[model samples]
Target: MASLKGLGYSGGMDIAQLKAFPLFAELPDAALSHIARGATPLAFPRGALICRKGEFIQGFYCVLEGVVKLAFLSPEGHEKIVDLVHGGSSFGEALMFLDRPCPLYAQALTRCQLIHVRKEAILPALDRYSSLARQMLAGLSRRLHQLVLDLESYCMQPAAQRIIGYLLREAETHEGQTREVTFPVSKALIASRLNVTPETLSRTLSCLSEQGLLKVEGKRILIHDVERLRDLGPR
Candidate 1:
């Protein structure tokens, strides 16, 4: 269960906070202010269940700080990480249009703040602002494209390829052949995200360590060979 009494920013979102997100950035001040009036500012502690399957989402949520993951949980306790929403991004846009129960559970991976924009607030905005509608549709299209790519990875890629690809995504900066990637959440969550078991994840990391590819240090991994890792990704 999630507690609504999150620390700080208990009131409705201000127009500035609304504009901070690209989805609403192009909207006029008056439109944004109107939408902000209905928006709810919320915070959640790490490990809190933000929303669950079968819940009727009145609107989408935008991450203002920290990370939230959309996932599926089986009755037998198995878990699959569908996507991770970081700061400055929004989720559940499709839900508003679908008019159906949410299919996945959402949980906070870290202490996070979000703006829950009601469907009522956005529908009128979308009707009035073509830019806002386009942005929202673009966001949804990107998510769908990524989902297709994920399906391809899950179906066609080998386990090592998938793991290496996962590690390489966070390799935004590197010194020579070395780069560092930090796990923002637990290894269990990571394994689920990669569609692998904890034992498999451990074994793969150890193998890479033995091969002088990377060094694992509790939540951080130093990649010693970026090119080699990339070569292994999706190949």
Candidate 2:
């Protein structure tokens, strides 16, 4: 098991970055500074299990850097990749307030840096900072809205469209100005997130390539026509 590190933020991060998140947007500088003071930074090796399902909640975790996979493993031992959380995104927040066991596991897909926030410490911060409460509510609401969108896509869209839609959204949100979009996760992992078979995913990608929509260079996808891919999926 990897050990947690004390909060020793080497080069100071601009508190403004947290402000970009609606959950931390309203937090006053002093309050943000306080929370930042209390937070612990931890390192995770690639493929490390950061948190396991059903484990007692230690605290809420926020990804400070690198990617983390939020997933559920089946009784038969199959794992489903649910969400790939990026930097600035948080997890275990909703569960921190809930009474039930966590239904999912969180794993670091690469060497990652994370911050831990103890639940017991949250109320005082909220009391001292009205903006913190507002930010938390907004963050939670955005997550809920995203879940609804995922549900709607699954129920109302066909498989091809669903896959394409997801890829396009991913493409748009992809960082940098480069034409080639690198898939951070493996194809099998991506297939699991898309709720499709690996073979099916390959076939679909081939089909997309044949239609001149994209060029697959290993894990990187060079999107040839964004509008066409957008049109492939249901609106």
Task: Judging by TM-score against the true structure, name the best candidate.
Answer: 1
User: lDDT for every model?
Assistant: 0.84, 0.73
Give me the displacement of residue 208 in model 2, in angstroms: 15
Relative to the true structure, candidate 2 reaches a TM of 0.57
Candidate 2: regions farther than 4 A off: 1-22, 156-235
In candidate 2, which residue pairs clash?
A: 23-135, 26-131
Best by lDDT: 1
The weakest ten consecutive residues by lDDT in model 2 span 1-10
Clashes found in each candidate (C-alpha, N, C closer than 3 A): 0, 2
Give candidate 1 misplaced runs (Cα > 4 Å): 1-8, 157-235
lDDT of 1 by residue, 147-200 (tens): 875564445337767788788877764443448888989999999999998888
lDDT of 2 by residue, 1-235 (tens): 3423323446644566555555676777876776665566677877888877787665688787899998886688866666788888888888767866778878889888877777776668877777777777777897788676555434433767767877787787777444467778999998888898888888878877865679988898888888656645765
- lDDT (Cα) of model 2: 0.73
RMSD of each: 10.7, 11.0
Alpha carbon deviation, residue 33, candidate 1 (Å): 1.0
